[model samples]
Target: MGKARETILEIDLRALEHNYRYLRSKLGPETKFLGVVKAFAYGSDSKRIALKLQDLGIDYLAVAYVKEGVALRNAGVTKPILVLHPQAVNFDQLIEHCLEPSIYSPRILRAFLKTAKKHRQKDYPVHIKFNTGLNRLGFWENDVSHITEEISGGTELRIHSVFSHLAASEDLNEVDFTQKQIETFDKITTQIDHKLGYRPFRHLLNTSGIINYPEAQYDMVRSGIGLYGFGNEAQIDAELKPVATLKTIISQIHRIEPGESVGYNRAFFSNGYRTTATLPLGHADGIGRQYGHGKTYVEVNGQKAFIIGNVCMDMLMIDITGIDCKEGDEVIVFGKNPNADRFAATADTISYELLTGISQRVNRLFIGD
Candidate 1:
C-alpha cells in the first residue's frame, strides 16, 4: 500500500528565496530588511520561513505577538525577532527567548520596562512604533516627547528602531495620504532623535511601501507579504512568483440521480443525472463554506470542476461527472493549474486573506533547491 495523498500546501522555498532577494535588492543597501513571520508566516509555516530567512542572512524577523516570537525561538531561529504587538503577560517569555518587543502604546512601553527591571535586564533591545495616520497601533505624534524621555531615562532598555506602518502605500490613488504618512513619520523620528541626542534605525515601510515609497525607505524595511511572493501592487505583482500552492485529492466519487440534493442542508441539488466527487478537504482546511454554489472550484484532470452544493466541514463535493478522473485522482485546490489568486477572486476576496486564513492543520511540503 502507498501513502494517501491528502490536502496539502506545497511551499516553494526557491520562490521564497527569490522574493526575499528581490525585495532586498529594491531597498537601499544601508536599509535593513526585517522579514515578517507573524500569523504562522502568513498561514504558510512560520518556523520554516523564519529559519530560511535567517539562513539567507535576513537582518531581522517580526511577529504580531510574543508567542509567535517564542515559536521561532523554539525552532532555533537566532536572528533578531521583533514582537510587533507584544502584551504585558508575555514579556517574560519574550525576554527569555531574546525576542524584542515593538513598543506601541505608552502602556506597553511602561509594562515592558517594568518587566525588564523585574528581570534585572540592562539595555534590552526594543522598537518603538508610531501612529503615523494608521491609528491602529503605536504612539501618537504628540507622544514623541514622552517616548524620547522614556528611552533617554531608561537604564534597562534600548530603542533599536522607531517605525510606522503605511496605511495606503500600495494605492497610487492615495498618493497624498501615503506621502503625508511618510512626512509625519519623518517628523516624529527627527523630533525623537533630536531630543534624545541619539538616532535609532528609522523604518516606515512595508512591502508596498518599499515599492511605492522608495524615498521613504529610511534605515530598515519590514518585508512581510512580499517575502511570500505577493507585492499587492499591480506593478510588483508581475515580478512576484507566488510561493505557495494548495492542493488535495478526491476521496470518493458518486453517481447521483436528478433532483437529489447533496451535503448539509441540501445546499446543492443535482440538476440532472450527475456525478460528484467528494474531497477530503473542506472548511476545516480553510476552504470556506462560502466556496459552495459554484463560487469556487477545484482542478481535476487539468480542468475546472465546480464545487457543488455546500462546502462541508471536513469534506467538499465537486461536480466531477464531466471530468475523466478516478475516485483517488489528485485534485488541485489552488496551484499552477488553478492559481490561488483566481480562486480567491471567485470568493470575492484577495489572495492574502485566503492564504492567511488557511487552517494550520494542513500539511506544508517545501520545494526548493
Candidate 2:
C-alpha cells in the first residue's frame, strides 16, 4: 500500500535553502538578512518556513501585521520578528509577543510611544519607515526632524532601524529614480543620525533592491519574493529553483463529440472529438476563472495540456486529447518543469500573486528542512 493521492503543494526546503544561499552570496557576511515571511511566508506555510529560516541564521523575520508575528511567536520562533504594518490597536499584542513595529507616521510613532510608556517599557526597539518615493506608508523626508524631536523626548522607545521602500528597483529603465531614492534614504538617515546622536541600523532595499542595487545594501536587506525563487530577471531566475510545486491528480476523464460543449456556460466547444480531464481544483484553490478557455495549462506525462472550458469553484477541465494519462495520474499546475513564472505570465500576473493566492485548503508537504 502507498499514500493516497490528493492535491498538494510540495515544498522543497532544499530549494528554499538554495535560494537563500544564492541571495546571501550577493552580500557581505556582516550585512544582516531579513527574511520577509508575511502573507503566510508568501502563501507557503509560515510556521514551517519561519522555523527553517530561523535555523538558517536569518538575522530577522518580517510580517505584515501583529497577529502574524504572534503566530510566529506561538510557533516557538525565537528570532526577532518585525511587524511591517503594525496598527495601534495591536500594540499590546505586539509587545506581548516581543515583536518590533515599523512606525511609519508621526501619529503611529506618538501612539506607540504612549503605549510603550503605559507598558512601562524602556528603550523599546522600533523601526522607522520613510517615504522616499513609494508614496505608501512612512514619514516624508521633511518629517524627519519631527520624528527626531518626538523620539528624543521619549525614554520608552529607541530607533532600531530606518528603512524606505523602493518604487521601481526592478525596472532597469528607472535606474535614475532608484538612485534618487537611495540618495533620499541616505539623506534622511544622516539627518536622523545627526539629530539622535547615534546611528541605528538602516535598510532601504526589498528583494529586487538586493539584486539591482547591491551597493545600497546598507546595514540590512529584506528578501521577499527572491527567497521564494523569483528574481524578476532571467539570468537570476535561472540560478534559483522554485520551492513550491502545486500538484494534483486527475479525478475523471471525458470524451466529447464535435459541436459538444464542456463545463458550465459551455465555455469550451469541441470542433472535433476531444479528450479532457477534470482536476479536483479550481478558483477556490487559487486557480482563477481567468485560466479557462485555453489560457492556462497543466502538465501531464511531461506534455502541456491546455485547460479547456471554464474553471469552476472546485473543478477545472483540461484538454488531454493527445496526452497519455489516466484517471489517477499526477498533474502539475506549476513547478520546475512548467515553472510558476511562466504559468503566471500566461494569466497576466506574477509569481508573487500566484503563490500568495494559493488557498490554505491545499495541504503543504515539506522536504529537506
What's the TM-score of each model vs. the native?
0.96, 0.98
- The global C-alpha lDDT for each of the candidates, from Candidate 1 onward, is 0.86, 0.92
Best by TM-score: 2
Model 1 Cα RMSD, Å? 1.9
lDDT of 2 by residue, 1-369 (tens): 122288898888898899999999999779999999999998898899999999889999999999999999999999999999999999998998899999999889989998999999999999999999889899998998898888888689899999999999999999999999999998999999999999999998888898889999998999999888999999899989898999999999999999999999999999999998999999999999888899887899899999988899999999999888899998989988788889999889999999999999999988777
After TM-score superposition, the amount by which residue 183's alpha carbon in candidate 2 deviates from its true location, in angstroms, is 0.5
Alpha-carbon runs more than 4 Å astray in model 1: 1-4
Clashing pairs counted in every model: 1, 0
Off by over 4 Å in 2: 1-4
Which residue pairs clash within candidate 2? Answer: none
**Shift in Å, residue 219, candidate 2:** 0.6
Instruction: For residue 263, give model 2's deviation from the true position in Å.
Output: 0.6
What is every candidate's alpha-carbon RMSD to the true fold? 1.9, 1.3
For model 1, residues 21-115, the per-residue Cα lDDT tens digits are 99988987888999999898988999999999988999989999988888888889999988888889999998999998899998998898889
What is the overall TM-score of model 1 with all chains considered together? 0.96
Best by lDDT: 2
